[model samples]
Target: MTDKSRKPVRKAVFPVAGLGTRFLPATKAVPKEMLPIVDRPLIQYAVDEAREAGIEQMIFVTGRGKSAIEDHFDISFELEATMRERGKDMSALDGTRLAPGHCAYVRQQEPMGLGHAVWCARDIVGDEPFAVLLPDELMWGKTGCLKQMVDAYQEVGGNFISVLEVPRDEVSSYGVIDPGKADGALTEVVGLVEKPKMEDAPSNKIVSGRYILQPEVMRTLENQGKGAGGEIQLTDAMARMIGTQPFHAVTFEGRRFDCGSKTGFVEATLALALEREDMAAQVRQIAARLLRG
Candidate 1:
């Protein structure tokens, strides 16, 4: 789809209310989304992706002990003053902070599920279609994954989700979608099964933490019961909206790192560091040595 055809996705909701139980000790004090992928924090990458997709109103659905996540996006007067005094080139820090009224934060009282966290932002999202991004899923591409999905949303006009193929053996770990017809980069979702058994999986397509959902989804989620893990599964709610509204999965050409996992977090750092000009030589040598061993 052409750039002009891309409908402006003005608002986006970031669900940061999860208790990072997987990364225990580190997560005890610091929110997992605040953890650095390489240089930038995980949540920053998500915000960058949303901005790339033309999102204007950024809403963060957070829980307790997540002040750092909010502070990261706020202007640090002392830090900025110090950088200016030292004549440091801090342009990279420019877009990190949000201006007054441009951002909003709401608390998800309980760690219910992705759907519940998203539901918390319903009033902010209002009646328009809004984008949902899970910060833990870090995607790398020339154009952000959400940008691609936004492009597809413009053409399809219902709901667009970013999808990728995961191993069948790993199907039970993710929300898998049954893909129907293939239309260019878009795939029609026939069904959505929340982490089905390996043999029961309809297809290999997994929802990769990015979505462009319609306002109607809020109603479905409002009355939706708990699904997988006794949590209000967002996939389940979105699945109900299927056929009633058009749902398409945009297969992005990119690398996705599940930074929610310890292994995935390290992998993302290694991959990004290996690609950087300053770190490439050292990173390559270490990788080569490790391979030799």
Candidate 2:
């Protein structure tokens, strides 16, 4: 039973305006979010996760070269016709299409930070608590990360960010949380430090891309100044809302692959390939052969 006292999270925002410079050459023409994990693109995994969480609408904050993403969601009349005529098993594209009016897209004019990208969708999001899922982070489990966060949000819903414990040595690469108290999977978030030094990190727990944030934070981002890499940082804005609202970090119980990096992308592809019933045996043999070579 969902708590009726708190507002239900019906919308989700996806910030996909990044330049993808890290994966350059490949990302030169292709958007990084369109890159594949197994057979599905990163954006597909993110959208599927959002859908699993019962998100009513998906709002994508895209950039100039992101038209491919819009086309990917649209019905491919020619391709479908060909498949149908050939009598091929087109069941593979089952979950790929979304109903009209279910999706909305807005352009992020410049390469501003995450905060700015999210701010661009303020009018569409309009006065409701919403979820943010970054496509670069591929979260894998029986239960999707956003669904897990949404479940937690329903019970105690002020603000929730999905988090997971990373190695202490690698904590400097992520935004670490200052935990106040723990209640099962929920922990009171006292503070958030974006990429803190090893000695300054409050805990090994790092913030995942999944967030269920109150709409009021958009106001904070409205006046937010550049921080960290001189880009308007979303973490800084989120920190401001902590003391005033119920801020908690829900610990994720599954694996997270940083698809933004080459190593992580390869690892996720290999990991997911091994889980497929159709090709698991072949993938294992190939992996073993590569090791021997």
TM-scores of the candidates are 0.94, 0.97
Q: At residue 16, what lDDT does model 2 achieve?
A: 94
Off by over 4 Å in 1: 1-7, 290-293
Residues 1-293, model 2: lDDT tens digits:
22432688989999999989999999999999999989998999999999999998999999989888988888899999999999989987876787899899999999889999999999999988899999999999899999998898888888889899988999999999999999998999999988888888999999999999898989999998998788888899999998988899999989999999999999999999999999999999999999999
User: The CA-based lDDT of model 1 is what?
Assistant: 0.89
User: What lDDT score belongs to each candidate, Candidate 1 first?
Assistant: 0.89, 0.91
> Which ten residues in a row are the worst by lDDT in model 1?
1-10
Give the lDDT of residue 27 in candidate 1: 94
